[model samples]
Target chain A: MRILALPPEAPPMLRRLTSGLRRAALGAGALGVAAFAPQIARAATVHVTVAYYSAATGPYFKQMAAAFEKTHPGTTIKIDVVNWNNLQQVLQTDVSGGVPPDISIIGTRWLLSFVKDGIAEPLDSFMTPAFRNRFIPVFLKPGEIGGKVYGLPIAASARALFYNKTLLTKAGFPNGPKTWNDVIAAAKKIKAMGAYGFGLQGKEIETDVYWYYALWSYGGHLMGANGKVAFDSAAGVKALTLYKTMVDQGLTEPGVTNYTREDLQNLFKQGRLGMVITAPFLIGQIAKEAPKLAYGIVPVPTGTVQSTYAVTDSIVMFKASKVKKQAWQFLDFLFTKDNRVLFNKNEGFLPTTRAVAADPYFQDNKQLQVFVNLLPKAHFAPVIRGWENVAKAVIDAVQSVYLGKAQPAAALKTAATSADRALAQ
Target chain B: MTASARRAFAPRMLIAPSFVLALFIIAYPFFDIARMSVYHVSRFGILGGFAGLANFRRIFADPVFIATVWRTLVWTGAVVSGTILVSLPVSLVLNENFHGQGLARTLVMLPWSVSLTMSAIVWLWSFDANHGMINATLQSIGVLRQPVQWMARASTAFPIEILVGILVSVPFVVTIFLGGLSSIPSDIYEAARIDGAGRVQQFWRLTLPLLRPFISLAVVLNVIYVFNSFPIIWVMTQGGPAEGTQILVTYLYELAFRLGRPGEAAAVSLAMLAILMVFTTIYVRMQMRSAEP
Candidate 1:
């Protein structure tokens, strides 16, 4: 009867009352849930932070984060971009401060130390059997410590020799050197042609560590089965002697001792160096910054074995992270074939998954494929707990040897002694 | 309360906030660093079990640490002496009532206003081996055919750093000396002239002695600043060209941050702090001696 004779304002009031009643019913339902479980009363958005490198790779990560948020409506993902020089310190400080990013791209060489410190959470518990089998085996090795997986490789890079094609041709070697002896001969030829035969980072850790890539290729072992410094072995001494001879022969730049990655890259771009052993990730940067250089990427020259240093970037969860589940969700999403293709495409990273590497995007890329081919032959750095100290000692000794202040045998001995002492610490 | 009590109470209140500030700003960090220095903290800065004197022993045994200490001393000495000697004349010129004295004074102090890192970058570009402005200018003037690789060579790298340090620090030194010069009444110079004292004699006997306090203050400041300098040396060479440019601060930064040897870095920093305390003690003594009747 009231509806039959309803005033115009009464209908509006009735509509409002009905909507308010519905909201109150929903609120009571939510309160019922809260009363049943107190934890639900404090339910909050789980914020996960993921970090990556590569100025070009930041946007892809953001897109991945967006997709992850879309898939899980209530969760959020944060992406942090770090430059190479500061990444190690930033990660160290965060983990050490007990407030690490939920997931981060840690250097493969840095994983052992992080794992040893108990800062990296073992991902084995989270990874399904199918997920574990997706990546290349070498890509899996860096994140493995004591047979426990602490990280999962997302993007990878490998070191190889880059040569100036025109310079190599002028030096009577149309193709890049395939062996150490040939490299030296070609370097000397280039030196005679008024160009630096080679570019090497003789000053910093690059001297000791990068040269080890060459040494291992020549059947050298930095640490023997006993795990002591074995750089004084026959192969180690030969590797060091060859390096010193190149410097003495004026086949390398006089200022080689001062070169870092930036310096080496610039010199190569300027046609001052015939060849440099650098990572495949540099190709994209070179193409962008100096597009005119006629260059070739080949396998790192061999001594007796075909080997190269493989660097992997892995997404590691922090031990203290509260949003680890969300972090894993984001990590799993990142390695899916489609996302991996986008990530590896713009970033110049080799996809960790063999299937992703075989995608049409990477299959036809000749320069990129050479690096892809080397994936099987790649070896990771030593996974010792105190590898940083050992690496620094070895670098200092190499510097001493290169500067002619100490003999190679003595320097390597000192390095090994110090390294052993550090390992003990 | 009586008027005297009220005044005393107000003064105490005025100083109370500062005391609280001192506890938070100075005492807290001092005690923290001291605590960290003695502990064998892991690279992650978490507390590992204590090992007495282990870190100090490790630091002493490190050749790079020893080299860095010597380098820090050399850098401090160079910056202090270079800053004072150069700025002394600059302040003298500025103190004279010459034309454009205001502009000259401002220009002399301009570098002090720029941050150290910015100054380092500017100087680095000027000193670059190839395509640097300095080299370009020198080449245009037919000074040399080949550009000098100023930062690449071991011998030139530290010298270049020292030169830049001197350039940045001289402005502050000159300004402080100018203040000292101004406080000495003009009548003193007039009296010396009237007494038939030559300009050289007056400067050595009168002006030098009068400026001693300022010189001591500037030396202490310069030494502390130059010894603690990291950005300039780090940006230019990063203790490189075979660690030729390494000073104490850069060495500590590399060891702690780059090499992940916090224990060694902390030990070296404590040793440096000990050295600087000695410098500060000596400075206080000099100040006391100068202030004596």
Candidate 2:
């Protein structure tokens, strides 16, 4: 009851508090500026946050950035590498949050998904008639969604059979496998020599898709042109049977169910495997990780026709970009013959430009020549919206069959039903 | 104002910030997720009109989803029970003052210090079929003539994943139980020893009953964490060997993130949430009962 209000004489105290508050705010502001100085400086660069994948090709990317900035005065390219495995999710989050990169390089297979979601801007408006004619036809196919070109084809990775020359020599084959049958036969012999015949990834959808690439090359398309799930066809059955034959013949490891690119690479590096169907980029990894082993590359062996899986990286502009023209300019500069050659030659990827492909530098690089030769015969996976689901189903189906969880026919049937449903959506 | 009104006002004033924060952080997302569970929202934006309960219904009818739910239950059950069973004894042992007991406790908690993804990868490397340390060690010791493809076989993958889960989970249980063990008065153990109680009987009669709160806490936490664990299975096998290791969370991740089926993913998330809620309710009931005099 005796507690009296001191309001009449509180003005002095209030003034002191206000001054303290002002001083604190100023102090905080100063600290904030200091903390953000590097970011402010970083913002002035082109700031291309490329998903940081590996230390292997990082220097090359830096050189490309430096070269791009040098050619275009008053511009600097900043590459932000995201983890490769989380690249799609990171890009999606970036775009969804309205903080998308000016230009994002994404897998060709992902183009349709990004476009279908309407996050990716169609590049046709940016591409002049002259520039539109520059891309390889198939590389452009995967980047198109709903008859609109949504991305700029930067580079394509055509998968091929990379074999250990010493293993082949020890097996008395002297030369690497040529045809699918020859590969299978050579695999059997290689296994007899206490080495894995062929490193086939049979665990996940990604692993299974590699097998499907070979299957499709053997005249077994998963979905026929008529839109029926053709993976259950006679050709499909034949392809599965060939795989089963290989597994039974000790041509592949008994524990092929969980095999992955890393496992296959490890085996090849250790000289415990004869060959694996993988991308050209893995060759550089091998050269760095295990240089002692002599290796050879051939076009992916075919059964019915010559075909290898082609995955490309495309420069996709976000629909939310404030500067679309600048984004296009950056992409055009990156895709030019000179820059394209420099990027591809340094990155171990085959260039998307025909001129870059025909460049004497690529022709001279024996490793580059293998991918370049294969690109002509390469088949890009069907890139319709919901194709990711189809790919997953296909991968799962292959894993199911390999694990003996389901027969090839049964697995394919399940996959076909799921894929058809996904595609039909 | 009356004392009751003043008391009410005081509590309300105290809780106002928390209520507002919860409204912004938790309640908003909770309701949004509830809405998303039913509606078909694309990653870019809402594409279609209301699907009503179609997303939920689709999740139930889908075989892969059903399988994933079952696998999730199995994963949770295995990891939780296995973590409790393995950790209780380790905790009890460490409770006693023994030589290097502190070091042992630290070593047990070492796996917890590492991230789940890193632990899973290390385990994956160890569980490698060919040149893995486990296989090589086993073969060198003449125990296993040939290597076992731990992650390859459908039959073996679940157990291996559970093993990894248990590895990450046990330390938490051990740490919790250790706290409980320390809290229990030494007088109780002394009284039990005077009553001619052996180690097993002492544990069964006194230690366990008193540590019921800690046990329940550990179990409840393990169930929720294990149910939602994505990285271990995803990194090791990627829900493969034909999706044998495809738990609900991993499957939902693939559907939403990998396959771009946000609507279905949202549905799966709600279903998994409902499941965890039920489990939590049961746990709470058990805890309440054990807490009674």
Q: DockQ of each model against the real complex?
A: 0.40, 0.60
lDDT of 1 by residue, A38-105 (tens): 43323223333334456666777777777778878877665666666778887777655445667777
lDDT of 1 by residue, B240-271 (tens): 76577889888888878887778777888888
User: Which portions of model 1 show Cα errors greater than 4 Å?
Assistant: A1-52, A203-205, B1-17, B137-145, B290-293
Residue-pair clashes per prediction, in order, are: 0, 7
Assess every candidate by TM-score: 0.90, 0.88
| Predicted candidate 2 versus true structure: per-residue lDDT over B29-68, tens digit per residue | 7787778777877654344678898888777877888887
Q: Name model 2 segments beyond 4 Å from true.
A: A1-47, A51-56, A70-76, A170-172, A226-228, A286-292, A365-370, A374-376, B1-3, B45-47, B192-196, B290-293
**Fnat of all models, as shown:** 0.47, 0.67
C-alpha lDDT values of all predictions? 0.79, 0.77
| Candidate no. 1 TM-score | 0.90
Comparing to the true complex, what docking class would candidate 2 get? medium
